[model samples]
Target: MRGAIAAMVLTFLAGSAAAQDLQARLNDYPTEARADYVFGCMAVNGQGRDVLRKCSCSIDVIASLLPYEKYVEAETVLSMQQVGGERMSIFRTAAPAKALVADLRRAQAEAEILCF
Candidate 1:
């Protein structure tokens, strides 16, 4: 009986650790960043309550698919690409920058399919 009880306790502890790891991964995206994504999404989609829910879902999908650091890198590359100057041309033409943006776009596409 004692051996069975010990096995059950070990199983419970393992499950708890797994849950904590999952929670940490899910929370990698900061609240402000998530809010920014949802607000931008809502602006393009709509301002209704249902749109809010969808936008929130979209960001959650994105957060699940892409790490925050990669997301930020892609965002920076995109923002830089928007600038009209020789100095900013690298953002438009560089292979690394393109790859970063491509990863972000793929994540967004996945999010769109799943959320909307």
Candidate 2:
């Protein structure tokens, strides 16, 4: 019984994250979110001059945060940043927070509903 209840809670929470709207999440996204993203990018990409570039996060991250078109744009920006300088771009060119905030808010709302 306890196991089943815990499973349900986890499943419900995941569903709530999926239910969030992209735009709303972006709009409501906190500054710390962006900072964390930047720091994560730096940590993942590393700081240095190399012939090849490495990224901090995976495509799944963008796919999770943005729509297909936005994801494409994000990729383009990342590519450009990589060519120019790794630290100079990445998160700076990531999908807009307004969009993320929409998704977050929606997901949070859904989770709240499921939680009670």
Candidate 3:
């Protein structure tokens, strides 16, 4: 029926709009950052063309889960935690810093599950 066809068309349009919105959000993740993540992921997982696909998927999942600003903050805190010194203690011990890294870790874990 025409009514059913119209409903289907509307549903398709809505889905397309949602897909575009999600792509826009994903675009907020910079190309260089995404490439760096994929490269690191591939290095850890093993290098190969197949690894490239998996790593790319991993970054995509991460992009979907996090805004770029939060991702960057989390990465910086985590990196600072690796440096051994009293001055770096804040990054290692602060609750807010820990929470930010935790959020990033959770997003990574989710990405691993979904992509790897």
Candidate 4:
């Protein structure tokens, strides 16, 4: 009986640690990046209090779905795609770049469904 109680305590501690780790990962996006996302989302959706809430929720969902590094890679690819140069063509045409963008897009889509 004592062993069972100890095992339960250990299990609960392990679960708490796991939850904290997941929360830290989900919050890996920098404040600036999260703000930028929310602002862009609000601009596209609308500038209102409710829009603010939804936009915040959207970024949170995206952060939960994607890591900060992956998000940055996808954003960089998208920005590079806009430059008018032969070098920029790689971002526009490369499979790897497309895949990064697709991952970000999928996260955003999931965020949309959840938040809006």
Candidate 5:
């Protein structure tokens, strides 16, 4: 029926809009978040340990899937820094987060876990 078709169309449009919003939010995520995402990926991919190869793969995967903005969100939502076993980082990013991403990628590239 026409009513059914209209309802389906409305649902599809709403879903599309929501998907766009999620993408936008992901893009807007902060550098710290991105780091966190990296940590999470490292944790998951490397047998519950931080493995550089796994981390790199995870970052690459994320970079390929996200637009610049979503990548920023991933970076923001995921970024973190551990100093003397204390984790610290900014949790929100209102800017591009590219600098953070670049810095983080470089740090990750060079990092070796001193403990754990």
Candidate 6:
């Protein structure tokens, strides 16, 4: 029926729109942040052209998995955890901080499995 055909077309268009939105969000990830991740990944894996490809793939996967704002929050918590001071205790011990870092870690782990 024409109604059934129209409903299928509407569903397809909606799904296509959502996919484009997700791709736009992933593209919004910053270049500097992506470069920093690739650099650190190369340092751990090895410095080579192949490592470059793998690192780039890793960041792409991470961007797909995590929104840029949440990624930045997780990175900030991790960086603050490295400092030594009473003020820094919250970064190390707070539940919210731990959860943010955990989410980032999970994303990174998934990226590694998929890309590396």
RMSD of each: 1.7, 14.6, 3.2, 1.2, 11.6, 1.7
lDDT scores in order: 0.92, 0.48, 0.91, 0.95, 0.55, 0.94
Ranked by TM-score, the better of candidates 3 and 4 is: 4
Ranking by TM-score: 4, 1, 6, 3, 5, 2
Model 5 stretches astray by more than 4 angstroms: 29-53, 56-116
How does residue 16 of candidate 3 score in lDDT? 100
Instruction: Return model 1's CA RMSD, one decimal.
Output: 1.7
Output the better candidate (3/5) by lDDT: 3
Candidates 2 and 5 compared: the better one by lDDT is 5
Q: Pick the candidate with the highest lDDT.
A: 4
> What TM-score would each prediction reach against the true structure?
0.87, 0.23, 0.81, 0.93, 0.31, 0.87
Please list the residue runs of candidate 3 whose C-alpha ends up more than 4 Å from where it truly belongs after superposition.
1-21
How many residue pairs of model 2 clash at the backbone? 19
Error of 6 at 19 (Å): 1.3
Error of 6 at 83 (Å): 1.0
Native-referenced Cα lDDT, model 6: 0.94
lDDT of 2 by residue, 1-116 (tens): 99999999999988787666554544453445544554664575566533012221332233345555553444455446556556666445556634444454454344334332
Candidate 3 on 35-61: residue-level lDDT in tens?
999888887999999889989998888
lDDT of 6 at 23: 84
Per residue, candidate 4 scores C-alpha lDDT tens digits across 53-91 of 999999999999999999999999999988998978999
* Cα RMSD of predicted structure 5: 11.6
Model 5, span 1-116: residue lDDT tens:
99999999999999999999876754554557557767776676564444655664555445434455545444554544322232333433334344556555554444323212
